[model samples]
Target chain A: MKLSILKNELNEAIQNVSRAISSRTTIPILTGIKVDVTFQGVTLTASDTDISIQSFIPIEDDRQTIVQVERPGSVVLPAKFFVEIIKKLPSQHIEIEMQDQFQTLLRAGSAEIQMVGLDPEEYPVLPSIEEEQVFSVNGDLLKTMIKQTVFAISTNETTPILTGVLWNLQDGELKFVATDRHRLASRAAHIEVDTELRFHNIVISGKTMNELSKIIPDQNTMVDIVVADNQVLFKIDHVLFYSRILDGTYPDTSRIIPNQYKTELVLDTKKLTEAIDRAYLLSREEKTNIVRLQTKEDGTIEISSSSTELGRVTEQLEVKQFNGEALRIAFNSKYMLDVLKVIECEHIFLGFTGAMSPIIFKSTENVNSLHLILPYRTTT
Target chain B: MKLSILKNELNEAIQNVSRAISSRTTIPILTGIKVDVTFQGVTLTASDTDISIQSFIPIEDDRQTIVQVERPGSVVLPAKFFVEIIKKLPSQHIEIEMQDQFQTLLRAGSAEIQMVGLDPEEYPVLPSIEEEQVFSVNGDLLKTMIKQTVFAISTNETTPILTGVLWNLQDGELKFVATDRHRLASRAAHIEVDTELRFHNIVISGKTMNELSKIIPDQNTMVDIVVADNQVLFKIDHVLFYSRILDGTYPDTSRIIPNQYKTELVLDTKKLTEAIDRAYLLSREEKTNIVRLQTKEDGTIEISSSSTELGRVTEQLEVKQFNGEALRIAFNSKYMLDVLKVIECEHIFLGFTGAMSPIIFKSTENVNSLHLILPYRTTT
Candidate 1:
């Protein structure tokens, strides 16, 4: 294989795929990035047995030549060293040529690096699925859905099914739900999709979903999602993201969501988040990391926390509206902070059935996102 | 103690002294900062047995009132929590007051924090030294001396004396020397001092010197340094720093520095440093981290390094002049990099005694700083 490419273009493409290169050397071949050169352009692939990433640089971009291919071939070079040398090369253009015995030469300016490359046949092939059962959605909406629910998924391996986010689609609406038994987060959005496109059971591991969220751009551009029997693919622009679906069925979480509440309060989201954050800082030294909230009849909410060894902190916040009766409850401050971070609204409505029941938090402006947290029992 | 101080001023003073607060809880009082309020001003002090820092906020600055003191007393509060609370308090001026007992109230806006305070008498007292043996020098020059030689101090605890920098004064010249037996760095400067202020020996611990270096400003303003039998004190414009001296005899490193050499080379410092840095990055994968340099008869230098596992890198640099015979030598790239960083000159002169002896690095512009590194024996 012999090629000369612009240094900036190759650096960008290599960086995109380098994120998937395995730092662990358990699988020796997994540490190499597969490079393929053709008449059209050059493609770089890297995978760590879980998620695979590939980036392609076409020969022409905006009427400018990027790559000149002398011959078409494939080879796998060490990803870490190759990327470092390319980044530090002191030239605008780089020349890369591979010999018959897998000896690769990289030259730029006055520096030359000769490294042994591995045969491309030793690299693992990425699984390919036919484009079937596909749906189109806005990239920004999909990114928001992933961000809102992915953090709530259980990380414990014992309950493997709970580690995947549940995806349900029906009537041009897409919904995502994730839970760790103690707290839950759910989000829904409307997308343009054919009425016949429906999925009864499809769940992607939360780990893979989170990784996809980072690479996908948060814009209004449309992306196509294709589902196979055991795999799912997201195609946006020139990038393709593939993930394996969980084999077990997700648990039914609809019944656990509270339908009614006796006490309700409406407050500004930013003010309440800051107050809870301050209370959290004071409660970090305590055993349960709990903070108490009490609503008075005069439309005032008091946030307080105390530790036996670290003193106490109390803050007062004004509530917009309160209904039903005065209530006092205690819950983990970290869980509440996490839920507040995902609720994208100026004002939020919180519903409580009783002291021990799970509380629901939803935006007063948008009803698409919902968060629930279980209260901790306090002796006082 | 009862007073109201501007939040910004209080925050800055706390941050400066908090760097010396002990994170270990064995001596609980050492983890807190002592706040002393008097009719004159407020002083914050923190110490960790080895180093002590004190920052004073006067009642006025630039004809503006800052702190208003109502009662004269002192108390110690937890350093971590006090700093955090002051940083996050939502007000321009914070009110801090102590009651009959050891309970302190800190209030700003609608937020109030009540923390338990310890009696200031229980805190460790900082050593007091007279200003009879004091000399004034430019802050910038002192900071430069610490930065150049401190990095060469030995980090191992086997020999306690090598872990400190040796300071010697003679004939109105102050010199600093530090060595770990492998490499050595020395810097000298002329300063104004009383003739009777001569010191035979003064060795400050590396850890304490580093702390002082960070807090001292690099400028042309003068700073007062007071020397005691076992402690040294530095009084800047508004900050006072005290450190305990290391108790050991420093080795004489004057005999180790070579005065003459068999070969000498003069080259641009920036170009040579860059070439050596690139070679070091490529040679890091090898066990010895060794980079080789050969001086050709035509006054050109070739720098190269190779790893059996990663490959090789080579670069050429043009030299201005070369004396005596041609030579080749290998040395630790890290040590060379450190010495190169401290050479403050556009062109540097390198003197080599032999293949196995130490190489001397000196500046052609400034003759006050010198660096020496021992060469590594290589098979090829």
Candidate 2:
């Protein structure tokens, strides 16, 4: 294979595909990025047996002309070294040519690097999926949904199914849910899709979802998600992402959410978030990272935490409204802080069923995002 | 102690002193910052046995009152927690008052933090210097000298004295030297001092020198360096820094540097440095990180490296002048790279004695900075 490409274009494509390459892969060829040249353009592919990423650079761009293909062939070169050399090359254009007996030459400016390449046939092939069950959604919305719920998924490998996020679609609405049995996060959004088409359940590994979130641009561009029996493909502008689906049933989380509450309070989200953050700094030295919340009859909420080894911190904030009876409860400050950060709202309402029950946190402006945290039992 | 100080001022002072406080100290009181309040100002001090830092916030600055002293007393509070709370306080001015025994109250806006304090008597007292052998130097010059030599100091504690940078003064010139027995770096600058006052030898730990470099201001500001029998003090404007001197003799590095060479080459510093850096990246995969350099009779230098596991890289650079006979040498690329980065000149002259001897890198514009790197013996 002999080709010359713009340095900037090649750098961007290499970085996108490098996210899927793992240095510790058991498959030797998996540690390299496969490069293929054709009349259409050049394509780069990388995979780690779980997720595959492929990016294409056209022959011509507005800024410069890239990828002049002299001959068409395929070769796999080391990913880490190739990326570093391309990034540090001091020229606008770079030339990569593969000679006989798997010798790859990369030249840019005064620097030239010769590396050994592996046969492209040794690399694993990416799974293919049909476009029949495909749906389109804005990249920004999908990124937001993943960021909000992916962090709540269980990281432990003992419960393999719980390490994935559950994606459900019906009618014109899509929903995402993640839980670790201690805390849960759920988000829903409306997207344009075929009215007759429906997906009852699809669970994707949290690790794969997190990687997709980074590779997909967080803009208004639309991305087509194609779902098959065992493979999932996400097609963006010039990039294609594929991940394997987890083969297990996700537990039903609908019954775990509290339907009613005896106590409720509404307050500005930013103020409460800052107050909780300050309290967390003080409570980090104590076990459970406990912080207490008390609602008074005079429409004020006081947050306090004290550690015998460190110090004590108490903050007071005014509540907009309160319903039912005034009460005091304690819970993990970190969990509450994470929930508040993802709500993205001006006003938040918190509902409590009792002193020793799970509490619900929801935004007044948007009803799609919800967070639930279990309260800690305090002796006092 | 009782006082009300501006939150910004308090935060800055706490941050400065906290750098000297280490959580792993054997002495419990060393983990706390000593806060002393007087009618004129409030002072905060923290020590980690090796170094001590003190910062003062006066009652008035430019006729503006910043600190209000309610009572004259001293107490020690946990350094880490107090700094965190002061940084996050939601008010312009913070009120701090000691109440009862071992309890300190901190108030700012609607946030209140009560922390446990230790008795001030338990804290280690800073050593007092006579200030008889004191000399002043420009803060910028001192900072520059520290940065150039401190990075070469030995990090291993096998030879305790090698971990310190040697500071020597003679004939109105101050010189700094650091070496790990493998490579050495020396820097010097002219300074005005009393004719009768002299400091022949002093060794300060590399870690302490690094800490002082961060707080010293740039420009023509003067800093007084006072040498006591067992401790050294730096009085920079209002802040005071004290460090315990190392208790051993530093090796004489003058004999290791070659005064004459069999071959010499003059080249642009920037081009030479970049070529060496690129060679270093390729040599990193080898066992010794060795790169070979050859000066030819045609006024050209070649840099190359090859690893058994990795491939090979060769780069050619033009030399402005070459004297003596053609020569070839090998050395650790990392050591040479570190020394090259500290050079402050556009052009550098390299002098080599032989294949197994040390190579000296000196700047053509400045005679104060010198780097000596020992060559590695190559089998091929």
Compute DockQ for each candidate against the true complex: 0.58, 0.69
Docking class of 1: medium
How close is candidate 1 at the interface, in terms of C-alpha RMSD after superposing the true interface residues? 1.6
Q: Rate the local accuracy (lDDT) of all candidates.
A: 0.85, 0.87
Worst 10 residues of 1 chain B by lDDT: B193-202
lDDT of 1 by residue, A15-106 (tens): 87777776876888778888999999999888877678788889989978999999988999888888887887778888889986677887
Q: Count the backbone clashes (under 3 Å) in each candidate.
A: 0, 0
Give the CA lDDT, 0 to 100, for residue A348 in model 1. Answer: 95
- Could you tell me how far off, in angstroms, the CA of residue B117 lies in candidate 1 after the best superposition? 1.4
Clash list (residue pairs), candidate 2? none
- Report how far residue A350 has shifted in candidate 2, in Å: 1.3
- In the order shown, the chain A TM-scores of the predictions are 0.95, 0.97
For B1-380, candidate 1 gives per-residue lDDT tens digits of 78999999899889889878877758889888999999889999999888899999999899778999998789998788888878888788888999756778888876778887888999988998977778887888888888889989999899988899988877788888999998999999888976555775588888877888778776766788998889889998778989888888899888989889898999889888877877787777675779998987667888888876566777778987788778899999989989888787899999999889898999898889888999999879
